[model samples]
Target: MAMTVVTGSASGIGAATFSALAASGREVVGVDLRDAEILADLSTPEGRQAAVDTVLARSSGVLDGLVLCAGLGPQVSDAKRIVAVNYFGTVSLLDGLLPALRGGEAPAAVAVSSVSSTQITWADNPIAGLDESEVEAALEVGGDYRGQLAYAASKNALTVAVRQRAGDWGAAGVRLNTVAPGAVDTPLLQAGLDDPRYGEAIRSFVGPLGRRGRPEEIASLICYLLGPAAGFVHGAQFVIDGGVDAQFRPTAF
Candidate 1:
């Protein structure tokens, strides 16, 4: 059986994907804050390292697939925390697991980005090019609006990183890609709806489909990308946002 590691597997898209993969008979290991096979926070370097170590040991240094769904939304109050978990955390875990993935059979990886990356303008975003120290300094100065900016920047950066590393990953027989979902009806979306700061915005945004997406819908796309059919589908950013991206940024993508 193929062994896969899915982060943020406790809830939302991660949970849905975990169930789907398990039902398909693959040996799936989940990493999350709680209620997972490997419980470890993705927001800190130490936590990421712990998750990596445990996963490699558990999978016996061989991994067939990886899905990085752990993240924080724009409604989160801590800007640094948002960037730390979403961007750095995802990147760190992916890098750490690459060796194991390379050792496995036709390994593949998928990461979850957000449609908000396109909606939010990040041309002048300081976090885009900054190193760790510079990012911290910028976030500190950003004050009240840093969280939102961090959210967008993190996703955007993630998308870019996946594309940038595609060549190397392909050379090693490991495919890497990203998925950007719109307003999906998940625990994370519920948290945004519960927040007074971003509730209205979250509620107001709708796609041409006229409804929020289900977690399984996103999982379907992810699973496809991880399967044999996606052999040629590499270094791609799939926007599964219910046509929202189509309606607004028709030509932007």
Candidate 2:
């Protein structure tokens, strides 16, 4: 039986991905902070462990795929919370799921990153070596800061980790990669879209695509990457940002 694990399955891309995977003939175990069958907080060690435990239990001690879709875009009062959920959360969960992945056939893990990370230059990362506590300490600088930088930084870290570990996992016949999504119309985007100024900017930013992306569109690509179709693809970041990244953000024309 093909068994897969999906995080952040309560709503948005995670929920849609879970539904897609389930429909693909894979027995999926979804992990969320809500009161779902596979409930767990990705930011907590205990919660991450619980999610892995549930997957193992359901899969009879193995897992075929792991979808690391649980993440946030700097909503907390502190930026550390963003790193905790987006960066460290992904690392912790992957570590816990490694054993189960090793036992499965052609195991693949897809992490959901963001197009926002493109702004972060890979060479000058300050938090690259910092521990979780250090990350928490940095967030102590409170002010009008929105933690948007932290959100992009965290995903940058995740992208690096995925690339770094791909070779190691490939030795074990497992593939690990990341998907960087553009502006999508998930409930999570409501917080930004509700703001008049921000909403107007975002609406115009998704140019050419003409609108925010549907969750199912992203889910379809994720599913394809996890399946045999992307057999040769590994350790790469797939950008699904609808050409927004190529836009002229600093122009007056």
Q: Using lDDT as the measure, which candidate wins? A: 1
Query: Model 1, 128-182: lDDT tens per residue?
Result: 7677556767766556767777888889888877888999999999999999999
Question: Which TM-score value belongs to model 1?
Answer: 0.95
| Per-residue C-alpha lDDT of model 2 across residues 1-253, encoded as one tens digit per residue | 6689888888899999999999989988888888456877878767777777777787887889999999886545567778888998899888888888999888899999987666666675556768887886654443344466677778888898888898788888888889998888888777667755356656676756677788999999899989998999899898887777766442521
TM-score of 2: 0.91
Q: Relative to the true structure, how large is the alpha-carbon lDDT of every model?
A: 0.88, 0.81
**Candidate 1 overall lDDT versus native:** 0.88
What's each prediction's TM-score?
Answer: 0.95, 0.91
lDDT score of residue 246 within candidate 2: 61
Looking at model 2, which ten-residue stretch has the lowest summed lDDT? 137-146
Query: What lDDT does candidate 1 reach at residue 174?
Result: 96
- Model 2 misplacement above 4 A: 139-143, 195-201, 248-253
